[model samples]
Target: MIGKHLFSVEAKHEFVRLPHFGPFLTATAAGQAVDSLLARFDGLSIRMHVLASNQPDGVEAKEQECAYQLECACSEKSPLSVVEPLARAGDLPCAEEALRIANDHGVKACEIGYLKVDEGFLLLHVHMVTADLQKAMTATRWRRRELLGRPEKGEVVIMTTPIPMLANS
Candidate 1:
């Protein structure tokens, strides 16, 4: 919940095709950015879509509609953008190696999630979705520790406070 409303990214296989971390995060981040954009441009009527109009890609101009949409992904939302991450930057991408890269980068310390609003900063959800549901459970423990730093006994409610860094900086 980073903005005035819940805007969403309608991902095609192109974005969520897995193993490719930067693309996945960038695509997902784009959705999150759009949601935030909606909040910023609340009064205007925005016609939004995934920006796919060409076989190689057709959503070029629409990517620039917002400030946070990341220049790279928006510029080449078509076939050319496939090789790299346009917005969100992280450890190098592997062919469907998002989980491995994430773990290596520091799973216990940080995992990515969709951005949510927190204080004056944005939020993120970095859980890896797997058919092995048990694996997803770690997000709980990791989030608790990273956010609250090990609550003492009897501690129940936890709140998150994000420290803002420029997007993709």
Candidate 2:
């Protein structure tokens, strides 16, 4: 099984100018990128979510988008993260998808927050709670069998990633 460690994430902006479309595109994209990265974590589930004030105009569309991203993240089997270059490839749909899923699960409920930005980077946040840390470690191992009905043996990797968005910026 993967190692056991408290995982938490809070993003930071690097201050790079985003495309002319707007900060929504930039911020949302970064959030999605975080969801993708989180998906890599073994058995790492989205415990909660929070909608940004700048989110989409329509509520229905936004819910669909959030659900999708969280689904992707739920499917992961490894701890996820983005290096300097990879972080820039954030996706908007991913954020929307994750949001929906988090909302549906009602596990990691929503809360007000902000992303930390510096230079050109942005941070999205997730607060995960585990009753049993060992259980969480074991959970990652069963993912393959639970979802795919397949079994394998290997060391489950532990994870520690900052939130999708930053906080206290």
Candidate 3:
């Protein structure tokens, strides 16, 4: 069993409320926000969530405040691996393959980023919710049975965040 201490890197980002249309973060501003965050926390695995608002129906709220929350963490001793970036247009196959490889190796978590430079956003896909390190360790152990020759296939939980492409990139 992997030690829980191996995944103890907790540096989370505060929620950033920006104008958004519907529940999607497809706007250029959303992309910029994500890019800025990635730059601020270099080398750390960042997971972002689009927080839902509780506004009343038909309120006609202009400049609706949409909170983009980010959860970031990383550790040198962690076993989690980030798959290579793939094109956004056709990344399903690549993501599936990555998940398969992770399951085969008994990896409890996986990260896959889709580069959509033309669309101005980088789609980040993670196999777990919240960057909680302890949960990862527990899940890993539960999946890796001692009596069983091989670990059971871990759940493929996908959490995605769209990061904006840098101006130079």
Candidate 4:
């Protein structure tokens, strides 16, 4: 299941500042940055959401609220260089391509983030309406491979639901 606590205090601030640093080229780079935040802050809560740059205005508004709800304290921004090597390796799809595929598959938004607090395995949370669940799941499966590059055996968790439905749950 997707954790209700998606971001640590530090991670929230980092995400809020990510845009100023520049666009993350790939999900792997973003994930690596998230991992770094967790390590640096001893963050127990962390999550990564992948959404299209051109989302509808309504969706964008809700996302801003969501970010606010997940706020935390940290001023240092993660350097893009930490993850640039993996991003330049060319093994994963660029953020734009991944977002395009997800949008085409009816995924309103998706998240790749840490799962168990102690285990440190990754979890993928796919958000979409019930009508789009199937296609969204397929897109999420593709994303799993892209983000994790063969996730550790028995360490994968996939969760799905509409974002509104997840707000209080």
Instruction: Please list the C-alpha lDDT of all candidates, in the order they appear.
Output: 0.30, 0.33, 0.35, 0.33
- Between candidates 1 and 3, the lDDT winner: 3
Task: Give per-model TM-scores.
Answer: 0.18, 0.22, 0.21, 0.22
Instruction: Report the lDDT of model 1 for residue 25.
Output: 21
For candidate 2, lDDT tens digit of each residue in 1-169?
1112112223322211111111223345445645654544333333222334433456445444544433433343323332111122133324454455445434232321223345443322222323333454455444324435323322222223323432122
- Ranked by lDDT, the better of candidates 1 and 4 is 4
The digit string of per-residue lDDT tens for model 1 on 50-133 reads: 332223232233333333233322322211111111123343333344444445544322343322223332223233433221
Alpha-carbon runs more than 4 Å astray in model 1: 1-92, 105-125, 128-146, 150-169
Pairs that collide in candidate 3 are: none
Q: List model 3 lDDT by residue over 58-77, tens digit each.
A: 32232232332332212223
Candidate 4 residue spans exceeding 4 A from truth: 1-23, 55-169
Off by over 4 Å in 2: 1-89, 92-128, 149-157, 165-169
Q: For residue 133, what is the lDDT in candidate 2? A: 34
Candidate 1 lDDT for residue 122: 28
**How many clashing pairs per prediction, in order?**
13, 53, 0, 1
How big is the positional error of residue 137 in model 2, measured in Å on the Cα after superposition? 1.3
Q: Rank the candidates by lDDT, best first.
A: 3, 2, 4, 1
Which 10-residue window of candidate 4 scores lowest in summed lDDT?
78-87
User: For model 3, where is the 10-residue window of minimal lDDT?
Assistant: 1-10
Tell me which of candidates 1 and 4 scores higher on TM-score.
4
Q: What is the lDDT of residue 52 in candidate 3?
A: 40
Give the TM-score comparing model 3 with the true structure, all chains together.
Answer: 0.21
